[model samples]
Target: MRAINAIRMGGVDVLPLVEGGKGVSISNGLSAGNWALAGGVGTFSAVNADSFDVNGRAIPQVYHGRTRRERHEELVSYAIQGALTQARRAWEVTGGKGRIHANILWEMGAAERIITEVLEQAKGLIHGITCGAGMPYRLSDIAARFNVYYYPIISSARAFNALWKRAYSKTAELLGGVVYEDPWLAGGHNGLSNGEDPLRPEDPLPRVMALRKVMRDFGLHETPIIMAGGVWCLEEWESWIDNPDLGPVAFQFGTRPLLTQESPIGNAWKQRLLTLKEGDVFLNRFSPTGFYSSAVSNGFLAELRERSERQVAFTTETIGEHVAEYGVGPRKRIVYLTYADRERALAWERQGFTDALRTPDSTLIFVTPEKAREILEDQTACMGCLSSCRFSNWAQHEPDYTNGKKADPRSFCIQKTLQDIAHESDEPAAVERNLMFSGHNAYRFGKDPFYSSGFIPTVKQLMERLLTGR
Candidate 1:
């Protein structure tokens, strides 16, 4: 195999490798800093990252606000402080070597404010900004204001073209790269559009080529296209390296780094990765952001599946074949359901799923009394983490501050579950009970010989191994 060479990215020559950012402090200063230390671009997630106190201990992000809007303010403040700290740490670790990029979900609450504040406070520390999870049209403007490069993560060439023509064209100089995150292979909040079939994943090579062509049409020929998701080894992607048709290219690893020593995930999460089989990672639409995500097929996902399965359409007034009267909630509000559906609901009730919660689509999902209470409590404690959440119906707009829809019980509170999974300890079931986002190729962890006997590598060691085309 040919030796891997450094590529110019964000105005710096670093190995054509990037650590895909994980949120809720999953990818933090320590991990991203070490990744930069290894001569690769390190991307630390600014989405509610953890801030440390003077004693070097993480400060718990507790909300003391009375309303969701108030708590949203607190969340934004916390995120800015955390992002600044992570940027500083990553810059320090580079030692005048690689580059550090801050990643943020555009759908995150007050994303523009948080990124602007972090960049204003930590100027010269962060070299670039990587943003996705939404259109993120304002990202280039923000990066240009800060004199930093911006990388927009998109799954399709058409999406990139739309962004380039609309907003990115203005700040074309600051556009560092375009990240092509495969919707099917990537973990956590996939970009699968309405036209694409989730079950039928298309080849990433063709998709990336199409993206490169669009970039070329926009006169962005040299901008590297970062191929993210399902990129485990460099050997498998040798054809993508130095390919003339694709132009400058880089590989992003979202799952392989979870077992590294610098990774912040718990030991149980790492152990679970090693035991996963080929089909263990499941792709489902359970996120409050209304985006499809990939996660481990654990107890948490199973419960969500069961909840959606026990659903039935209903109406308050009589309609065709909807004459079966059913009472829901403590008030016993009567709704009409189909006779066959009523029997199914009754059967679910016999199995202890007696609480029927209404969804935004006029459907009711049955759950146990305890489960219903927990769900309500979780919704009540909403901090407005996302700009628009289906679970809590929390929208970050003026006046009503709601999504103008009924709070859907089918989707769980993402803020609560993500925070719990990222930092939870001592609880034995936390790993299996919270969302464990992983790429479709996460099962390779069990088969990879380099990780035999559970030998986790440091970020530097992982970089070295990757450079060897393994």
Candidate 2:
């Protein structure tokens, strides 16, 4: 195995290993700080991070606002305070050892405002900002304003080129690095574009090389390209090390860190990771952000798959093969469906999935009455977590504050599920019911002999093991 060497990143020399930030308190201060203390870059998730009370107890984020707009304001306030708290905690643990970066989603609600507030309050503690889930063209500007390095996460060379040409070129000196997250392999929200197929996984070498070419064209030869997703053993990536084609490279691990002792996830979640098979992790486009994400194919995901599978197209006026008439909702609004589809829909309705919810694509999905009520309640209680949500039809814009479409029932509230999963006690039931974001390589925990006895390593131990290319 090639010896791991320190590299200059974020204006400092450190090991080119980064702990990828997971949101909703999955990767907290302790985990990230410990990684930084191990002489590597640590990224704490700033997206709805947790805050503590005076007694050092976790403060529950219970919303009391009646309107979605008011709740969104409350959420933003909580997020800023939480980010500051996490940043302070991480800084205290780091002891000024290595670089500390704050991670945020570009498509998150009030992303710019939340990031600005966090940076303002926790100025010196955070050395860099890493953003993903969208084309964060304004990230460079934000980092420049705060005088910190910026890393924009992209999946393709085209995305990086677009950001560079539009805004990144102006803040060239502050360009710390470019994170090329593998869309098909990464956890959480993926950056897979419309042109890309999720079923087909591409080799990262060619993609990273293309990204390096783009960076070199922009006079950023020295800047490192942080490779994220599908990265497990460094021994396998020995060829990538010191390769001139992809200069100054780093690896970001998101799933591997979740098994560490400092990981904020519950014990049940940790145990679940050790038992997963290769095909357990699934990549799907069920996210409210309208982006592809990878997660465990648990009962939660299976339910969504079933709901989508039971869907059929409908039209207001009969046309072509849409000859059968069907009624939807309490109003019994007439819609046309095919004779075969009508029979299928009737079968589903008889099976207690009587409520047919219309989707944005002119399709009706059947759900149980109880599930329908829960979906409505969740939508009603939306605090606008995302910039725009397909499930709740909530947009951050002020005038309308709506996506101008019916709330799709196929998707659920991400903020609600993440908060529940993160804060829930060490219970398998709770963990299995929510979205469990994980990288495709997560199944390796079961196959790896190191964790055969269900042994969970601390952040330091994990870093040491990774450094040895084990």
Candidate 3:
């Protein structure tokens, strides 16, 4: 294995390994700070990070506002406070040892305001900002305002090209290394575009090389490319070391860091990672952000799959091959469906999926009455977590504050599920019932000898093991 060396990144020399930021308090100050102290870049999630009370207990993010817009304001305030708290903690723990970066989802509600507030309050504590989950065209400007570096996480070279052309070109100096997150392998919200097929996973080497080529074309030769997703041991990536074509490169580990002692995830969630098997992680398009994400194939995901499977398209009136008329909801709204689809819908209804919920599209999905009620309640209690949510049809805009479409039944409230899973109690079953984001290589936790007998490592130990190439 090639010897790991320190690289200059974010205006400092540090180890090439990076801790990928996980949200909803999974990757907090302790984990990120420890990784930074280990001479690597540590990225703490600033997307609604947990803030503590006077007694050092986590303060639950509760909203008292009745309207979605008001609740969104509350959420932004909480986010800013939480990010500042985490940044202060990370700075204290790192003791000015290495770089500390904050991660934010661009699709998050009031992203610019939250980031600006945090940076203003926590100035100098956070060295860089890493953003993903959408086209962050304004990220560079925001980072430059604070004189900090910005890393835009992109899945393809084309995405970076668009970002550079549209906005990043103005603030080229603050363009910290670009992060090429593998859409097929990364956890949480993925960047799989309409052109890509999720089933066929491509090799990261070629894709990353393509990204490097794009960077070189833009005269970004000295800038490093951070390779995230599906990265495990350094030995496997020995060939990428000192490769002139790829230039300075680094690796970001998201799933591997979850089992570390410093990780903020609950004990049940940590233990669950060691029991996963091959194909246990699934990539599905169920996020309210309208993007594909990878998560554990638990009961939560299974229920969503089943709900989508019971769907049937409908027409307002009788059309060709849509002769059967069906009544949905208590009002008995009439719609036309194909004869075969009518039979399927009837069968689903007879099997206890009595309530039919309309989606944003011209389709109806069947679910149990209880499930339908739960979905309605969740939608009603929407706090506008995302910039535009497909599940609740809540947009951050002031005038309308709606997506101008019906709320989608196939998707659930992501904010609620992520918070529940991350802060769930000791019950493993309850934790499994919530969305558990994980990378495709999460099964390796069970297979790797390093974690044999359910042994978990500290952040420093994991970094050492990774540097040794196993």
Reference-based TM-score, model 1: 0.98
For all predicted structures, in order, the TM-scores are: 0.98, 0.99, 0.98
Clashing pairs in 3: none
Q: Please report the TM-score between candidate 3 and the true structure.
A: 0.98
Give the poorly placed runs of model 2, Cα more than 4 Å off.
none
Lowest-scoring 10 consecutive residues by lDDT in candidate 2? 423-432
Q: RMSD for each model, in Å, please?
A: 1.1, 0.9, 1.0
Candidate 3 residue-wise lDDT, 1-470, digit = tens:
89999887888888999999999888888889999999899999999999999999989988899888888888998899999889988989988666899999999999998999899988889999999999999999999999999999999999999999999999999998999999999999899999899998999899999899888999999899999999988898999888888999999999999999888888898888999999999999999998999999999999999999999999998989988999988998899999999999999989999999998789999999999999999999899989999999999886899999999989999989888887883579867689999999999999999999999999999998999988
lDDT of each residue in 239-341, candidate 2, tens digit only: 8888988899999999999998899888889999999999999999999999999999998899999999999999999899998999998999999999999
- What are the lDDT scores of the predictions, listed in order? 0.91, 0.93, 0.92
lDDT of 2: 0.93
